[model samples]
Target: MIFESSHCPEDSRVETQFCQNLVAQANVDRAITPERSTSISPDSIRPKPSQAIQQIILFTPSRASNPQIQAALVKLQNQVAAELRSRGFTVQSVPTGLDSASAIAWINRRATPNTFALSLQTDAFLNPDARGTAAFFRAGDPQRQQQAEELVKRILRNVPTLVDRGARPDTETAFGRLPFVRQLSVPAIVLSVGFSTSPQDRNILLTRSSAIAQGIANGLAPRPVQARSTTQVPIRIRLNGELSENQGFILGGNAYLPIALLNGLAINFQRPKTAQLFT
Candidate 1:
């Protein structure tokens, strides 16, 4: 169930150092920047089924809470709350002090039988470079409930390992980088954010979104794939603009694949572009 980016760099000090540099640059860039609200515009996107959607916004406080950070937290919480409400989500916040048991108990109290839960680990600090944030959903019809469970398992399994191994604030990032150990019993999607320099990190975000889009479309519209439908095809795609030199697995349709077939597909894969393949 481990969904790893095929292109994630091997663990090395030099590679880590390069990643650290990128992290510093990104932070500096964001530091002087104004806060802008971003969401899937209603005109461009449709809503998911409310009955099928259960959401939990659990907040965990960091172990070290500075005044500046606390102020920023207030701002982010307000922004995130407003954004979720606009998307028709009923948001709930839990401020748990670095206590895993208390956090779990709070979430258990708040979680519903058929709802999507967004648990924010308050203990972890947000870093742009080593972290990623994203949302995930099912891709195809008959998307077994187990698929949702497995996705969480695959997606969250790596978080704690990295943190335990000293995941730096700036250098190691991805939404799925933090380890969360709650057993999800229903079909649910998680919107995760974290820092990462590797394409594997970004690609995971892209694929997770694609899955959510596909799932919503199928679940709301109920268009089943044919039994004999081709779920996967080996394609050679030619990268042009931004996707030309992306070093990672390519995701197409509902699959995450290696980059071998980039030249086979007719996608405009170029530098600064991403060429995702179907596995």
Candidate 2:
């Protein structure tokens, strides 16, 4: 989420803090579930596990001594951190670390399995005409590429004014190149939510900061489904290439053999070595 202040540092602190608080509030309102609370409906497919742990790295052009900017960043990351934690993800928010160190820290964290890094940034290009959102993802990886594209669709779904600048290759900037992109093994993306130079773009970022943050959390959260009562029914045994017509019964969630009817099926049956004791 990008936050800008047209009124110097004064508005920056208020707007930035507001944005963070909004994300936290929205997430709570959404009632995000921390567990993989999957309910198997009659028509539902097999349940999938929760989304993997993710890292959100929100940045600004780091100022060595800008207290307002730094404070806002801390608040922003904190709110987003709480939002993500409620959604069944082990999330870490890296606020104010904008250079090589931030990217390096991502490397150390993503070394563990099932981890990804996402960044939010604000831009004020010399060209005030610059507008819209831009994102960077792993250049050649298809799965990572799709994740990047999905982000754009989700983030800008409600904000119609913000143009979809498209996902780009992280190839040349502090984030686009080797230390950050090329050699970084984990999936990573840098999202320029909006350019501050353009009045229109700047307003979108400042006004919709929490909404944008919520949009991001929603995108990253596991797709939840309605739960259905699980009543154990007859168990079907598939042998060779076909399923059993009515091969077994389920009781106490376990399939049991009706030994008297076993000979009716063509399935081969044999006693195990342990069964010799009973014989």
Runs of candidate 2 exceeding 4 Å displacement: 1-51, 54-76, 95-98, 106-110, 172-178, 227-279
User: Compared with the true structure, what per-residue lDDT tens digits does model 1 show for residues 1-279?
Assistant: 112221123235564455556556545644564231122212221223335554645353442423433443434444455545555667676663545446545655666654544433222222334443333343221343343334334334433222212212111232222223223332333333332343444344333433332332232233335565454454443355444333443233444435444455655656444643333
Q: List, residue by residue over 1-279, the lDDT tens digit for candidate 2.
A: 332222112235564466555546544533564221122123222212214555443334354444443444345455556767787666765444556556556555545456666665555444577777767654454665676677777778756678887776543232113234334445566666766557787666556666676666665664577565345466667767887675666644556665534677655788676642210
Go through the candidates in order and give each one's C-alpha lDDT: 0.38, 0.54
> Clashing residue pairs, candidate 2?
39-227, 170-176, 171-176
TM-scores of all models?
A: 0.32, 0.54
Task: Name the best candidate (by lDDT).
Answer: 2
Q: For each candidate, how many residue pairs have backbone atoms clashing (under 3 Å)? A: 56, 3
